[model samples]
Target: MAKAFASQGDMTDKQISFTEVGRDLYAFTAEGDPNSGVIIGDDSVMVVEAQATPRLAQKVIDCIRQVTDKPITHLALTHYHAVRVLGASAYGAGQILMSDAARGMVAERGQEDWDSEFQRFPRLFQGHESIPGLTWPTTSFTGRMSVFLGNRRVDLMQLGRAHTAGDIVIHVPDENVMFTGDIVEYHSACYCGDGYFADWGGTLDAIKSYGVDAIAPGRGDALMGQDMVNTAIENTRDFVHSTYRPAARVAARGGTLKDAWDAVRAECDPKFADYAIYEHCLPFNVARAYDEARGIAHPRIWTAERDMQMWDDLQG
Candidate 1:
């Protein structure tokens, strides 16, 4: 059994479920904040995603300590997000793994992303000083990598470009559970500033092709059964379509950004009123969807200054 160290925050949401999905696979979730996957092998452990800071990750690490003494040998990054990867040192894993696209993004706009995400959610970055620097994987794979953890088999695959140009999923064969990074969010608002709405939907379909029984999505509680998993996927799909459709329509009509934003808000806000970070993500999501519909395949990088400018323009 694993135990978690709890923390307090404005969200007032606290959850530490050490549910065993398979024989040795477990999920450590904190409500819908940021969930991490734990793969315990006979000799070592591979923590799928390290939280924002070591201090925050320690809570998850403390829980892992209760179950096994096997050193955390590997840390896998699903993508390049300050809230997700900056806390790499805490785990102190022997190796940090990511996809080649992730590394390229780090080399390109890691700092800007750090600033953007920090501005979006300050609570996730509790210990600002602890971040030694941008997190980089020691080893990076181009598309996929298959690894065996004792008797457990993990198939890491990058099916398409959704969350980012380079996104990966950790698939556990025995458990039939897929640990989707930000590629598939449960109830939380899917941040689309750097996302491809159409491609994101296609990626969701790609994920379903694996025939997963459960999914530990990027945010929100883990999907338990295939039905719940399908619901999550469907919700994500519907949200993406709802957001992009109006943005596309407004752009085609040569409306201002505010007009485009208004169009989507009327459609999405009511439906996704209770979803996580809906307000925080709405402006950025609308901005990006507007551009994507205008034929911008890659999203413009977000810097601190650019973020403020966009926020002022859209939010104000």
Candidate 2:
């Protein structure tokens, strides 16, 4: 390999921020790392998107403790990404939730993803030794499921495919606040390695239909108010489109992967070069985009070896 993935060189810890998106609803965000959401209900609490490792999860737990002593009864995962799901043990919630498609993905490529991500970004897995194994959902749903923490209701729905085949968003009706996982990012780059580019835009539209007042996005700052929320949604749409268009154009001409890479960079770099994880995600994103453009509907599973091989090919 000519050089390590960009994430591999990111050893510095990010500053954590626990921002309140609504009453009793919080977003746990790092500088640009994976984020978690907290919803404190009448009696218990529900957490969204566990961090990468048990140690990382503890930080979100600590933030939750400061606000409420209520036990976390539900842990909802939006998808099956290793970085978001491997920390399940830390929550120790009796009921863990994921979409049926997400659970299926876990069975298909969970271990491979864990190995690939662990190798790509060691910093995210600060306590990799403590991870029990691949996180499994005790309960799985097909489209939408509603869980009530006493009186407050948290609706988990699979809007459409975006970041992954089974991406769900947690919506709180009373507050009109939604916890969108990697489906909608604020300032950070969307990791589209396992994404469905063709269906992503429709999924974004589904999320936009709600017109929620506040959104605890997958990364970056907590979006509060309609203006900020709309801005993030559109920016995310732009990022996804910018990345796919050029790659698709290259693929349409039966161009090489390297050709698609250059075209994508030419389009995306000017706007997203400074975005967090932009470099780390570009090659994988381009490869996936190229594949999707060439008629691959399902994303190819990413393994540790494949990560290196793809990186080498792109670098060459």
Candidate 3:
């Protein structure tokens, strides 16, 4: 029998975990679902990665209320993916920030991504009607920008490209804790459909140089302690490398997309078969790697139509 299309069959609700990675920093994670980070400051808070919709984002808000009653003053989106930004209205944050590249993407292909993702995983889009529209940042930055919540400083930087061309990491200098958007993931598949395979590792290296005490990764459990942080970063590196190498090899041999898919599975399945969203991400990852290996510098925009077509072609 043919496999279910992308995460459509994953209807079961995941248990949510709100863990404090630092004194005032928290990670709101739901079993491999897109995670959100909370940074509580002296008088306000800044949130990273809004969930898919208003209803979903409210869950993060609920989690935030449990810890502190600080008003959410900033919403910093790390990228332009629909799942990460569509919930902007729910936060009621006065300032919404993104990298310039990310804001550009929102203007270019944000709706296509929104439609594509909504179809790929219906469960995540619960209360889709509540989404006001495509999320646009009130402020856009270049390399790095800092926000001061009273006296505490939070640095948001475009370290390098990994998950997307505009990925950013949020660092808390006081606690030495970082909220790495999708640039780093723990025990979860890196969704590389729009990623730069060649630049991902260097981005990981940049993140490693910080030697952070704790990290609330894009997904999976909140990483606490240097050892756990290091393990997740290296594992993410291995996952990216393992997926790209075999697909690149197949492309080098002038192989078909299906051929590249098979090669990547052979190389990645043994190690990452049990990872969250591994199966859902494999086909897109292989497709992007194949394109990159064939000298495609930029990833093509994914629409709902393209999503179905690609799935049909690969799963056949």
Say which candidate scores most in TM-score.
Answer: 2
CA-lDDT, candidates in order:
0.83, 0.94, 0.94
Which residues of candidate 1, in runs, are more than 4 Å off?
Answer: 1-13
Backbone clashes under 3 angstroms, per model? 0, 0, 0
lDDT, residue 237, model 2: 95
At residue 150, candidate 1 shows an lDDT of 80
Query: What is candidate 2's local distance difference test score?
Result: 0.94
Worst 10 residues of 3 by lDDT: 1-10
Q: After superposing candidate 2, which stretches have Cα over 4 Å from the reference?
A: none
Per-candidate alpha-carbon RMSD to the true structure: 5.4, 0.6, 1.0
Better of 1 and 3 by lDDT: 3
lDDT of 3 by residue, 1-316 (tens): 2666759888989999999999889999999999999999999999999999999999999999998999999999999999999988999999999999999999999999999999888999999999999999999999999999999999999999999999999999999999998888999999999999999999999999999999999989999999999999999999999999999999998998999999999999999999999988888899899999999999999999998788878878
lDDT of 1 by residue, 31-89 (tens): 66877888887788988889888888897799899888999988888988887898889
After superposition, the stretches of candidate 3 with alpha carbons farther than 4 Å from their true spots are: 1-3
